[model samples]
Target: MSDPTSPIGWGIQLAKLWTSSGQTFPVRVKDIALEVTKARFPEPVGCVIPHGISGIDGMLSKRQKKKDWCISYDETVTVPGRINFTIAHELGHFLLHRQQRDTFQCGQLQMLEYDSPESRRIEAQANTFASYLLMPRNDFDAQVDGHELSFELLGHCAERYETSLTATALKWLEFTTEAAMLVVADHDEFICWTYCSQAARRIGAYKPPGEMLPAGVLEEIRSKALDARKFRRVAPGVWHPSEEAIESVIVSDQFEQMIFLVRFPFALSVDHEEEPESDAFSDLAEKIQGLR
Candidate 1:
């Protein structure tokens, strides 16, 4: 059981209300933000509005004189998933961290923080709260049950939950039985962040955020106009020294980043044909070996 005073607990409690009322997918967080705050506190959320802010994705501000709260999100972000998540993130602050500070100004990175131990406690808590509030466990589980995990399948879950692909992928990682990792890299092919499932971690199939993506299929996809959606079987040393992995790629023009879904099999097949290592791949392998 989740702590009733915790962020996840509060989110679950609200989600239950929507579920019990026979409400459908994509929980209307904006409506609940205003209503819940008003019902619970005197200095409730006065408004949930959009602002033309440049750098800030969302801001939760308490009016100094009026003593009321307002949740404002960037209006220029056209993606419904990003906007909705930002709104929910602000709502998380309103519910969980309103008393911690007078205001919270969040950017893109803060919104993506989920369960990182090194992330700021309050920000991660708010993100967790927003994720649960937007996509509850029972509903999310039902959507992905019995399906082979892939970027295409996750895209459907994103659409169903009205969440960004990254958010949806992270949610799946939290509960998936497969050994998989979601890697976000910049247009330059430098890794920005990574989230691995427990199974992936157990097998040491993980990479840190700052490392450059090794020269391989993922790099080739970024450099050329290849099918970004197709999953390629990458050779050993590209991702792991002894184990080969399947790599799926997607380029997000909106965020100007590449998303890679890497899945590792439980055991390496001995009979699988091996590709001859190219000069670049060999050089990369040497570099990676030196680092290890």
Candidate 2:
């Protein structure tokens, strides 16, 4: 078991261990997560309870002015895999942010946004730890390499990583070379959030259909054309300014939660120099190792 004193540090070390073992991307992440948790805190770390704690997937706490620590989770969702991620998250807090606070209350979204800066830096660090520890870069790169942008492929990566579709997509965007963007939205037409790949960002591409496309661009006019299995290329200026074109595919589960993958034309090959890194996990690895 690696020390959790620095979540990023431990995550990088664990990623190296998994890579050396020849595990595949997404899959290696789950393997490393399970192995690290069982080795470090063998007892069900989810059982230790503290006062005033309400229902939640996981909790982290330390007594005032003392090094005494505790980590626990809701017994309801206490499967080994979920427990693994929870423990990893708590370990992140223990190693990275224990000085800032005695406890943290984590919901699903908070845990998902573990890499973003808007969230508490510590929380983001913890999430980054969990993500990197679970999905090592080498493995993720192999799965994504030579793969086309599609919902089915993303779903496969998600299952392999034992994470949600959004998580997998977010991770994929970290490494993909194509100009792609992911949009998550509800039935009411309100945009929940959006993430763009490095290429897409450099081209000044964004979602929500403002200034780029008229409002109701996706829902009103093109709703009938959306198909998760295939890509539809629209005319230039539909998604951005270049003579480059746009292709979009919509992924809808039964609940009406939608994931839109929009692809930009591959023109301006000169700008290829700014393409995203081949290994999405490398930046995180560098950050973690630097911390150590």
Candidate 3:
């Protein structure tokens, strides 16, 4: 095993572990894990149980000295995609964090959780691992390389990759060349979090924390409207405090709150000057997103 601490490295190694196929989708990861552990370690993973925990999304057994390991997850997680991510996350701990901690406990889908700093760090790594594993960049980029991101394009990718829209969108946002951002808000309209791509951030686009979602976006999600997936262009200082016009897309029917996927053309300067950074927005994006 390469044993790289970086999640992207670990994910690449895991994807190539199977000898018979190059395809990453529909990966029987549990089987590969069992085979690898049995071959590599004295204390190999032995069994996987779906009903071992309550309220918890997934967990790994306390480490033992002599070849005893088990993987377990909440049996009641009806969303197969979520369970798969949880399992992959546990496997990530097994590969990446096992030496640091004997057991791993994971919660249901969440973000920006207040926990010990160490635990939170590992959680982010595991999330990165899961995201990369489930949606390998090679295949994902093929589907989304030049296409403008809409819920439709992302929804199809989600079905193909067997992941939640949030996960899929996050993965795509990680590598997009387009100037785009994803902002999550709560039922009370408080901004939960936001993620902007390298291009978006470079163009000096930002949505600060604690700001309310635009009334246009709030009304779109609340309307029980199925046909609301087009560009909701906003002026410079609405949802985003930028000089450029932002094209926004509201993910509808999301119960209480909504998400806005905003995009705009990159900006240029005559003097080729770099925009000053927003310390507050930088801090906010560093926090985890997709919270619910």
Candidate 4:
């Protein structure tokens, strides 16, 4: 076994092990976590404590100058699927970034935005590692084949991976062959962030919702009905001429947010290109495509 020091290195090495051993993704994730925990600390004390502090999902604490460490999670987060993902994310940080810092605070956006270049690269790496560890590409790809990308389908994947709907959907977009986009909006006005699949980018499907939706647009028309599940499809000019259709689903809790799943015409091609290739990229691409 190679030294599991860096997050990326550990992830790649573990992914390879899982790929060859025929272990299931979720099972492998737990096994890796257990191995890492036991290797670092003495018996009984080395175990990862679940349902960490009141509000946080997971925690990692390292005493000064010690290689041995402790990891914990909030037990109140009873959703098994979400708990699994949080564990994987925290394990990622532990393996990859613990040497640099003693404590890590994880939240929804912070966990998923791992790919953002402007932010901490290690966080993104851990996220990538966790996603792959829990939802290996081979299994994910097998599920996605012949299935139309839908909220329900994404929800199912989330259940399978023990992650949130948003997380699973974002992962789906990362690897799906379909030209799809996931847009998250807040207050039905500002576009928080947008994620486009390889195919969607090629067709020029994007959103510059411009601080607010344009007057009389479907997003604006349905703004009040923010909690609705039925997505409204708009023609090309309404969203983007290059797209064959746009479907918007809004999820309003204490915060009103929208997720747009835009589907592009199968025949059209836009100039946008795929993400640059790297070791992490290869891992993710392979995981999503179920090649591993």
Candidate 5:
């Protein structure tokens, strides 16, 4: 493995810590930070404060007087899931990047912004640390064992991990065998981000971050209201404007944010998708065309 402080490697350290102490799942991250910081470092984290941090989700710095390390966050972020993610993110900065600099301030989009490779890499490291610390790989896989994929299963996993639906879904996609995708958008119907599973990428499910919402959605969806369709099978181009893509998509309306969980038929589909011009799937096509 690489260095223990690397994004993937840090997970190994966290896993070791979790297992050595009775293998607690959905680990109590903040408490662990307080315990581990003092145990593992010369200058321990003095505080993890959920207080006013004007423009950022989380910030890491050193305090005055004794000048110990401290974490600051926007106390206004009400959702427990978001708050937890933010703090864990700062802990990531503390564990991974503190040696590189004295202070680290991060906005919600820092990791996802992708403005520069170096900046994105560090931010992504923080996110990975947070994800692995909260949801261990073995525990997550055990939860999904023998169960087929669905939006409801994702909801249950999100509840178990105490993270947001989108965060947990993204984490699930990171390790799931099932094909999946998550698209998040703001209240103005703007695309915040999009994720394609390793399986889905074969058929080219990738989309740029700022693409507009496509035309086939209902008015309520366009308005970004809350109305989720559990699992609706749709033809290609409903979400993506491609002819060779079809998906079983789940739309969850988290008020302004819309999450679409698109699952494809098989990982092997892309390998077999290159077929002759003849309609080998004509019967299937006729059934689908009838719906329109």
Candidate 6:
């Protein structure tokens, strides 16, 4: 091991070990968590269990009377993908931040915060660790080699990795060659968040939260009942001023969210301007304030 100190470094090291050991798809994070802690610390993780915590995905805390640690995930998270990722996330905190802090509580929104000026460093690191550990880059790329970037394809990847579709799409965006953006909307139809691929960001294909669904696209989606059977060529003026995009939507009943996957036609020129960062810390603080 090449001193796997950072999140990505540890993720890579563990992922390689898992692969070398002939472990199959959808890495069993629970086993890895225990194995890792036991090898590195006398106070290894004593338990990875469930809790009925509200408004949070997972937590890691020191034992009350002992030096050991406990990792607890939300019992209400029925989705296997979400549950698996939450366990991996808590393990990341145990490995990286246990010496610095007594506990860590993470929410879904906080897990998605990464590579931004407003992102919490440790939270972002844990997220990166979970992503890389759960979905190793080499295997993920191999899975994506011949597939078109679509919800159907990403859904398959999600199944293979035992991760949520959102997480899979975000992982794809991390290294995709296509100019695409993944926009997630709350049940009320407001754009709650978005992640853009490198190609998309180069052409300034990004949207801010709190915006309504793009004009006309919403009506089309509603008419189709969010089937995702075909992509509609939305005109330049809809999603972006200078580019046209093909759009598709998937409605997730479990999460009560709408996911829009948009791919732009190749751009003739690029935008050098950048989007301003949101008050992410303040927003996260407000969300977790009730717990305090």
lDDT of each: 0.73, 0.58, 0.67, 0.61, 0.64, 0.77
Tally clashing residue pairs in candidate 5.
Answer: 0
Residues 76-123, candidate 4: write the lDDT tens digits: 775447667667777787776765777777654444343444334665
What candidate 5 gets wrong by more than 4 Å, as runs, is: 1-3, 114-116, 186-192, 210-214, 218-229, 237-255, 271-292
lDDT of 1 by residue, 91-154 (tens): 8888787877888888754543323433356766667777778788898888889876788888
Q: What is the C-alpha RMSD of each candidate to the true structure, in Å?
A: 8.9, 6.9, 4.2, 5.9, 9.4, 4.6
Give the Å shift of residue 280 in candidate 4. 11
Q: Which digits, one per residue and each the tens of the lDDT, describe model 6 over residues 89-119?
A: 8898888888888888777656644344444
Query: How far off is residue 273 in model 6, in Å?
Result: 9.9
Tell me the tens digit of each residue's lDDT in model 2 across 68-129.
Answer: 56676665552224545565667666656766777776755455444456444565567677
For TM-score, the strongest prediction is 6
Task: Give the top-scoring candidate (lDDT).
Answer: 6
Q: In model 2, which regions exceed 4 Å deviation?
A: 1-8, 19-55, 63-69, 74-87, 109-119, 208-226, 243-256, 269-292
Query: Model 6, residue 291: what's the lDDT?
Result: 11
- What TM-score, to 2 decimals, does candidate 3 have? 0.82
What digit string (tens of lDDT, one per residue) describes model 3 on residues 140-237?
88898777678778878988877777677777777776777787776688886788776777766667669887776666557855342576556676
- What TM-score quantifies how close candidate 6 is to the native fold? 0.85
Q: What's the CA RMSD of model 3 in angstroms? A: 4.2
Q: Which candidate model has the greater TM-score, 4 or 6?
A: 6
Candidate 5 least-lDDT 10 residues: 283-292
Deviation from truth (RMSD, Å), model 5: 9.4
Model 2: lDDT equals: 0.58
Residue-level lDDT for 278 in candidate 2: 33
RMSD of 1: 8.9
